[model samples]
Structure formats: C-alpha cells, structure tokens
Target: MYSRSIMAVSSWNDNGQKQFVHDPYELYRSDFFPGLGWMLARSTWDELSPKWPKAYWDDWLRLKENHKGRQFIRPEVCRTYNFGELGSSLGQFFRQYLEPIKLNDVQVDWKSKDLSYLQEDKYAQHFANIVAKAKPVSGVNVLQETNNIDGDVRIKYRDQSDFEYIAGQFGIFQEWKDGVPRTAYKGVVVFRYPSTRARRVFLVGPESLKLLRITDS
Candidate 1:
C-alpha cells in the first residue's frame, strides 16, 4: 500500500525532485504514509481493523504500520491535498503552505511503469547513495555557494526554525512533521535548485545522513 502523495504538492515541472527529473512520477519512501488519500490491502486492513484509534487515525496508522518495520511510498508531486481549513488545527499554515500547494495536472501512466525499485530495502539503499554523494556546503551565506557547485549539494540545518529559513531561501515546502521536513527521506529534504537550474539541493539535518546507515565500500 502507498500514500497518494499529500504533502509537498506541486506541479510536475515546478517542485519535483531534481534527481528524478527523467521520471517525475517516481515514488520514494516516506515517514508519514497517509493523510489525503492512500491504498490498503484487504489482508492488511483486517490485521489493523480491530485496533484502530479513535483520534488522529492518519498519524496513528502511520506510526502503527511504521513500527511493524513497514515502509510507505509517496510521490514527489502530491496527488491529493487537504483543503478543509476549518478543521481542528484552525487554519494554521493554511495560507503559507496549503494554499500554495499546486495540484498536479499532468496524467501519469502508472500502469506502464516498473516501480519495483520503490521496495523498502531498494529505495533505502538508493536514497542513501544519493545522500552520500551530495557535496556538503557550509558558510555564513551557504546559498550563494550553491551557485558555484557543479552537482547536487547538501546544506545542514540546526533546527525547525533554521530549516524554515533555509527552505524559504530555496522556495521549497517549509512545513515539518515529526521532525521531518516536507518530502524528506531520513530527515533530508530534496528539490531542484535555483528555480532556473536542474541541479539538486539536499537540505539535511545534523544526524540525518547517519540514519541512512551508509557504510564504506
């Protein structure tokens, strides 16, 4: 089962992951699985049916499944969005985030694609390789240095506020949930760089790379 790509919603050409430019429809592993739309197998549903939580089912389901050593796949460009602004959170970040989320208009041929690489172990290994190869950039004005880099670059953020500020500089999604930025994998958020460039930008947390468990080879 997979999430229908809720967070980090944007057009295929606008805010998609730069690394997957040739296959923008490619799915990646996610920390939170579902919110707007998702799929569930009947067998899996039966296993979780009796133990459903009464509140925050989405969050609970994600944690529940995740605790079972399960991995969920989500699209870089979200397929669904949360428009109910009058909910419990009371329109918080509605304008700053939700309102700016662009619905994908392009049709993807999902049936024709080979998505086997999205399996838990394969995706984790592939994503880890990408993160390992990213050039770490550091400076008082780190964003400026990215302009001189030839390939993907990684910038570290100290905390939530720092992440928001960095995200603003790059104009990517700024929201975070459970210590993860939008579209993050192991606490690293990735997107195309400079708006005019196709190079990738990796916004990483202090210990994010370690979580990938990369080893010397």
Candidate 2:
C-alpha cells in the first residue's frame, strides 16, 4: 500500500476564493522548504563525505551494493531553492548519463543571421584556389549557336562524335551588354545531348551585345 502524507491543504472559502495551509513535515518534503529531506540529503553527502572517517567507506560500499535502483533525496527541494531538489537531482542524473557523448562530433547545419562567411578571406581564397586548379581539356571543338526567339546563347561541344555535354555541367558565357562585353554565369545543362541539342544557353537581356567589348580569348 502506498501512503500519501498531506503536505498541504487548499480550501475554497465561502466567496469561492482558495487558501493554502501547509504542514511542517510536508513543507520539509516540498521544494519550498529549507534544510530538509532532499536538500539535506545532498548537503549531508557533500559535508559528511569530506569529514567522514575512512571507516565509513565499507558501509558506503555496502549501501551501493544493496540499493542499486533506489532513489535518494536531493538538497535542492529541502533547501526551498524554488527549483526544488528534483531539478538538481535530475540535472546530476542527466549529466552522469550524457557526459560521455562527444558533442563536437554532432554535425548541425544551422541557418545563421550572421554573414561572416562571406567576409572571410580564407574561404574566398580556398574557392579561388579550387577554381584555379580546375583545367578544361583543350583542343576540343566548341560550336556556338544563337537563338533569337528565346534571346539565349548556346554552346555545343562534343566528348565523342554523337555525345553531348553532361546534364549537370555548367557553362560560362561572355556576351556584349551596352556596347561593353561582360561575362555571366549560367545554370547547369538539364538534358544530355543526342536527344535534344547538347547546346547550353544564356538568356541575357536583348541589346546586351551593343555594349560588347570584343577581346581575344
């Protein structure tokens, strides 16, 4: 049978207002009480463990051996710290179980408000180095085609006689804008060649070539 001690009593008065009456022993058991039960348990452990003679070690070992699953009171509740003994005990328990896990190994890609990654010179330099290392194979023939209806420029190149470029490969385009030449980046090809034209296109605004700055590549 489980015994429940009435730690507190709340009553509704004639006007329907509630009032609370607390028992001293129950208050000691409560988180609001100071220097009792759980609070006493944790504090006593801390104090006695230091001053306790070496002779107590045998009894401590025996207690651990006997009461493996038993729950003990904590000092937080008995001390009336507002948070209560259970919170403190829970914190200790979680720490004991979780401390061995390595938090650094967890990979979290968080979207941050800070744009510091854009300003970092090392990241920029690393990207620049990667771009510098990439070398397109030379001596390969490239065919240029223009589409007036869609206002796009297309480039067709061959790996073999009948094959088109890979679906995801990017194409860089140089075109004229306002009588000056400008370079623009384009999206990857969506379809491979032989089914459709293996051509990659850039749909820059019309009249872009009026500003073309023609220079030898």
Give model 1's TM-score versus the native structure. Answer: 0.71
lDDT of 1: 0.63
Worst 10 residues of 1 by lDDT: 5-14
**Model 1 spans > 4 angstroms off:** 1-23, 62-66, 86-92, 147-150, 158-182, 194-196, 211-217
For model 1, state the Cα shift of residue 85 in Å: 3.9
TM-score of each: 0.71, 0.18
Per residue, candidate 1 scores C-alpha lDDT tens digits across 1-217 of: 2433222222222234232233346566665443566666555677777887888876665453333545455666656665767876446465555555545567999888887676554777888888788888987777798889988888888888988988877666676655556566677777766535556778888778778885422
Writing each residue's lDDT as its tens digit, candidate 2 over 54-123 gives: 6534234223232232222111001122233355436753343222211122222324333232232332
Q: List per-prediction Cα lDDT, in the order shown.
A: 0.63, 0.23
